[model samples]
Structures are given as structure tokens and as C-alpha cells.
Target: MESTAIGLWGIPLAILAGAIRVSTPFIFVSLGETITERSGRINLGLEGTLVFGAMTAYAIAVVTGSPWLGVAGAMAAGASFGLIHGFICRWPKVNDIAIGIAMMQFGLGLAFFLGKPYIQPAAPHLPSIPFGFWSGLPQIQAALDINVLFLIGAALTFALRWVLANTRIGLTLRVVGDSTDAARAMGIDPHRVRLVATAVGGAFAAVGGAYLSLYYPGAWNEGISSGQGLMAVALVIFARWNPVGCFLAALLFGGAGALGPALQSVGVTSGYYLFYAAPYALTLVIMIATSSPNRPVPGMPGALSLTK
Candidate 1:
């Protein structure tokens, strides 16, 4: 009876651990997407941006022997990708969403091409904080090895939430996203605002990718990313564009992602491949539940193309 109770408890504990392990990328990417979406531009190319960022980060870390440098490199690559997307979108008659998809393909190609050499090289990994030191259990200690990115992501979420609600710059971004014409009328260049926002968004997304390659999975490969970047976009919607909500939604996604493997560990033998669909299925269900036929939610940016 005690063993049975412990086994049941392990499920929730494993879920929590999975959340910690998996939520970092989701938080960063969703937050980045939030910024871009808030500025009336969407970078669907984040998938590519993420892959390229991972490759850049891993390669740089391998060369420099510093994980931090890899993060910086990832940010630089991401910003450059964002700038390209922004520049293209600024051109008259260019479809930003379509451009984003194109960028993703381009990024993937570049990553595969460049990262080919670094596939076998090992890079320095980011440091982790062990919060479970006192638990005296190997599983607990492993579970509590929280990555720095998770803390940074959490802090950024609070900071962004505060900025969007109170700061002058946030107000400008909101105006630019809600109505480009209004922003232009106020002498604020919507293009400039969007460009900056997208750049910042890309930087965050890239960091998420870096975390994936240099920490969690901690390897360089063409298949390092598994739709995390794209799913993050959907997560942004499920989060209702709130940074804090993004954090919570990310944890949910992480749990969904962990379910299949965790179940397999416990001798459960049903629908392994289909179990992988949990996160997407949940996202779809949430979207259906939240969407309305009449009007947009209050916090949603007015100019967001997705909402329309």
C-alpha cells in the first residue's frame, strides 16, 4: 500500500520536474512572440530563428569554452534574423506572415548547413541551481537542478508585465500595435517600433533555443528543436498575450510534453506516439474554448492579425 501511494505521488512529482525542464523555452519564445504580436507583427519564422540560434550558440560555446558567450551569439543571430524579417516586412506589399515562414525555412537550412561540423563537438553547458539539495533523493536533486534561463525567464515575465502596464515605451508599443495610423499620427514611426519589437522578440526566442541546445538536450543536431518555436506561438494565444500567463501556459505545455515518456517509464504501454499529441490537442481545445464569434478580448492588441 505504501509503495502504491508512493508510485502515485511520483506521477505528480515527475510532472513538476518535467515542467521545470521543459518550460524555459516555452516561456522565452512565448514572451518574445507576445512582444512581436503586440507590435502588430508576427514572426512565424521563429522556428528557423530558434534553430539557427541553437547552432550559433553551440558553435560559439564550443570555440570559446563559455556558455554565456554562446548565449550572446545566439542573441546576435536572433536579432539579425529579426532585423531581416523587419526589413522585409517594411517593404510595401510584403506579407509579414508569409515572410516569417520563408525566414523559418531559410533559418533551418542555414543551421543545418553550418551546424553540420559542430554536431560532434561538445560545448560548455549553463550552470544550474540545485534547489533539492536537502531532499536526499537522487530524483529530487535531479529534478531541482533549475537552469538559470528559467529564473531569467521568470524575471523577464514580471518585468514585461509591469512594463506593458505602466511604462511609456510600453504605451508606445501598444499604440503602434493597436493602430499603425494612430501611431503615425502621433509622430511615432510604427515601422521603427515594430522593427525594434521584433528584434527584441527574436533575441528572446533565440535564447530559448540556446537553452535547448546548450543545457537541456545539450547537443548540436539538425533535429534539436521539436516544434517548440511554432508551438510557442500558439502558447502565446493560449496565454492571452500576458507574460505571466505565458509562464503558466508553458508549464502546462511542459507537462503535456512529459506525459508520454513519464507514462512509459511506469510500464504503461498504450499509444506512445499518439500521446505526443497531448500538448497540441490541449492547445486546440483551449483555442476553441476562448475564441468568440463577436469581439476580441480586452487585453488583446487591436491590430493583431491573428485576432482578426
Candidate 2:
């Protein structure tokens, strides 16, 4: 029913297409993580938030026949998770990282259990723009058929970068993240700002999950997310918690992920599985390159637990 292309030239094109497709989830998750971390809180549980959001988005889409509505539901669910994490961490002597790990497992279990029945059902997919229509080459047309969310993610990246650099809320977040004491001294509630930031972070991650289930791969299942959430944590580190950097880092991961399929498309199967490891390898490389025992990566938020 589908025709595969046959040409050495297609390899690069294939990689380009795959990069856009695969990087979308990364873009969203890292952007979300950027927000949370910038507020001086880390949310490793985003993997769970991402998974549960996938389940929620898929389930609602199937029931309501409107993927947009499903996305809204996913955002609400993700925000609830973020709120739970933020609130618990505010308690005296609480461990945020451990809570995030526990939440990740809980989200996975809950999603797997509730998503069982709905896996077999089909849902409406999000729409994409045909940017490649002008190209006579089918591969180019396919490569340019980008989802609207990717565009939105790009816009958010720029908007976030600007907001963080210029806005009053941005100033508050920076103060809260750099020194909780300073925030309190200025009559700003660090806890309140962090809580809101985490909620926003969760909402963004949920949209990424929505893209996963309702767009790419275009289905609901137990295996919809394969650690994209976790990878995003490393991505945030790699990006130095900068929104623009997160967007570029996401695209890099996406390109790495697409490398495998691009090679396969060119009939290189000798190390197909190895190609799948590209993103992880790239992640390790980035972390190693940006870090050392000598000093914290430049731009790391001072109040971050990792930095401490």
C-alpha cells in the first residue's frame, strides 16, 4: 500500500524528515523542563507526566472525536501532576528528585492500566501543513509536512527566551531560582512562583505527549513513549536551561534519532539497532562536553538541586 523510495540521495532527505518527526517530543519536553528548572525546581517525573498525558490525550480523543479537546484534558492532567510534585516538595525536608522518580513509575503504571482498553481504538489525528507541496519530489513534500505543534513549539521557544530575558515574571523566576532567600526578602513567594512554573512546565510536556499519541506514530499503546521524558532532563542540562538552546538541542536529538531510519531507508541494515542509539549517545556526549568536576555548567540556576 506504500511505496518506498530508492535512491542514495534520499538518505539525507530521509534524515531531515525523521529529525523533524522525532524531535517534536524532545522540543516540548525540554522546553517544559526549562521552565520548571528555571524556577529552581527539577521535575524528573515528567517522563510519567508525558506518558500519562499520552494516555489521557488518546483516551479523550477516541471518546470525544476531537483531538484538541483531548489535548486540553491531557494538559489538565499533567498540570495536576506538576502541582502535586511542587506542593510536596515545598514541605519541610522533602526530597524532590525521589518524588519525581516515584511519580514517573506511578504515571507509567496508571497509564498502562487505564490505557489497556483504549489501545485498540482509533482516534482523530492532528492536522499538518503541506510545506513541500511546491516541491515536485515526493520525499521533499513528505519531509515538509510538519505538524502545527512543531510550529507552536518553535514560537514558544522564542517567546520563552524573550520572556526569561525581559519580563517582570521573568525577573521573579530568576530571583526565586537563584536564591530562595532573596525571593523571600523581596516579598516574592518562591513557593508560589515555583508552583506556577511547574504547572506551566507540565502543561507543555503534556502537549508533547499529545503530539506523540495523536500525531506521530498516531496511536495509543503501552509503548508510546520510550524515555523521551527522561532524555529531556539531559536536554535541559545540555541547553543550559535556555529556551532557544532547548529548541536547538531537541532538533539535534531528533536528527540523531532519525539517523537510524535514514540509513535504513538507504538499505543500510548492518547496524540498524545501533542507529537507534544515536540520541542517547548524543545526550551523553553533550553532558560530558558541558560538564566537569571543576565547575557547574555555565548558566545553571544556582538554586537547582543538581547545581547544589
Candidate 3:
């Protein structure tokens, strides 16, 4: 009876653990999206970039027997993709959203074409910290074995929040996002600012892909990413464009994601497929709750297209 009671209590703990593990990618992707959207651009192609990054990271790690190299390669690929988006969007009357979709398809196609051989190959895994070493419980130890990316994602969130609120570069980013004309008037090149921001955002998104391939699932496969990349765009909107909010919202999404597995573990299996929609449902709810006909949220960039 006592063990049964303990098991019931463990359900929530397991969910929390799953949330922590699963939320890392969401944290990175959402934060990256926040940065890009804040700079008055949106990159829907991050989905493709993510898939390509995952494949590249896995292929590199397999060849070199070094997971760190995989991360570096992923960042390079992401940055290159971002550069392409930035350069192309600079053209007169270019539709950034359309370009984003095209980029996404291009990325996915490229990843599938290049990653064909790596599908079955084994690769090195990313390092993890053993925070549960002192807990003396198997569940605790498993929970504590956190990937380093989680910490990095958390730190980046706080750092980004501070930079946007306190830094001169952040001020300029805001100006460009709000109004390109205003940016030109202030002698701050909106195009240049947006280009840099998009590239950085791509790099971050690539890291999220790296985490998926080399750490969480840790493999090279065509299905490595479902819709995490696309869902992140909605997450940025749901977070109201705040990096810190993005973090917390990611955790919530993660928890929603873990619901199905958690429920199945203890014999609750009524609506398995429905559980998969938890994150999307939350996203829709939040969007409805916060959206307005006029005036964006407090932290949202003025030039962002999502709000309009």
C-alpha cells in the first residue's frame, strides 16, 4: 500500500523530470525565435535548419567520434542558413515569410539527401551532469542526469532578457524592429541589425537541433525532428516575445509533451493521441487569451509581422 502510494506520487515527479529533459530544445528554439522576431523578422525555415543541423551534427560526431564537433558543425550550418535568409530578405519587396517557408523546405530536403548514409551509423553522445549523485535514488539520479544544453539554454534566456533591457545594441534592435524608417533616421541600419539578429537566431536554433540529435534522442534519422522547429514559432508568440517567458512557456510545453508517456506508465491510456495535442492546445489557448486588435504585448518588437 505504501509502495503504491509512493508510485502515485512519483508520477508527477517523473513528469517534472521529463519536462526538464524535453524542454531544452524548446527553450533554445523559442529563445532564438524570440530574438529573430524581436528584430522584425521571422524565419519559419528554422524547421529545416533544425533537421539539417541534427543530421550534420550526427554525421560529424560519427566521423570524428566527438559530439562537441557535431555541435560546432550544427552551429555553422545554422549560421549559413541564417546568412542566406538574411541576404535574400534584403532584396526590395521580398516576402520574408515566403522565403522562410522555402528555406524550411530546402533545409529538410538537403538534410534528407545528405543524411541518407548516416541513418544507421552510431555517433558519440553529448556529456551530462549528474546532479542526482547525492540523492541515493534511481529516479533522482535519472532526473539529475541533465544535458549541459539545458543549463546553457537557461543562462542564455536570462542573459538575453538583460541584454534587451539594458544594452545599447538591444536598444538599436528594438528601434529597427519597430520601424525601419525610424532606424534609418537614427543612423542605425535596420537591415544590418536584422541580418545579424537572424543569423544569431539561426545559430541558436541549430544548437537546439544538436541537442536533439546528440543528447536527447542521440541519433541520426530522418524523423529526428517532428514539428519542434515550427512549434517554436508559435511558442514565441505565446510567450509574448519575452526570452524569460519563452523559457517558462517551454517548460509548460514540455510538460504537456510528457503527458502521454506519463499517463501510460501507470495504466491510464484512454486518450493517447489526444495527449499529443497538449502543447498545441496550450498554444491556441494562450494566443486567444493575449491577442488584441491593437497594441502588441510589452516585450514584442514593433516591426514583427505576427502581431499585425
* Number of colliding residue pairs in model 1: 0
| RMSD after Cα superposition, model 3 | 2.0
How do the residues 35-115 of candidate 3 rate in per-residue lDDT, one tens digit apiece?
A: 888889999989998998898899999999999999999999998999899989999998899999999999999999999
State the C-alpha lDDT per candidate: 0.89, 0.90, 0.87
- CA shift of 299, model 3, Å: 3.2
What lDDT score goes with residue 273 in model 3? 86
TM-scores vs. true structure, each candidate: 0.96, 0.97, 0.95
lDDT tens readout by residue for model 1, 1-308:
12244575666777788888888899999999999999988899999989999999999999999999999999999999999999889999898989999999999999999999999989999999999999866667777889999999999999999999899999999999899899999999999999999999999999999999999899989899989999999888888888999999999999998888777766666998887888888888888887777878557787887743
lDDT of model 3 at residue 22?
80
Candidate number with the higher lDDT (1 or 2): 2
**Model 2: per-residue Cα lDDT over 197-251, one tens digit each:** 8988888888899999999988998889989999999999999999999998999
Identify the superior model by TM-score, candidate 1 or candidate 2: 2
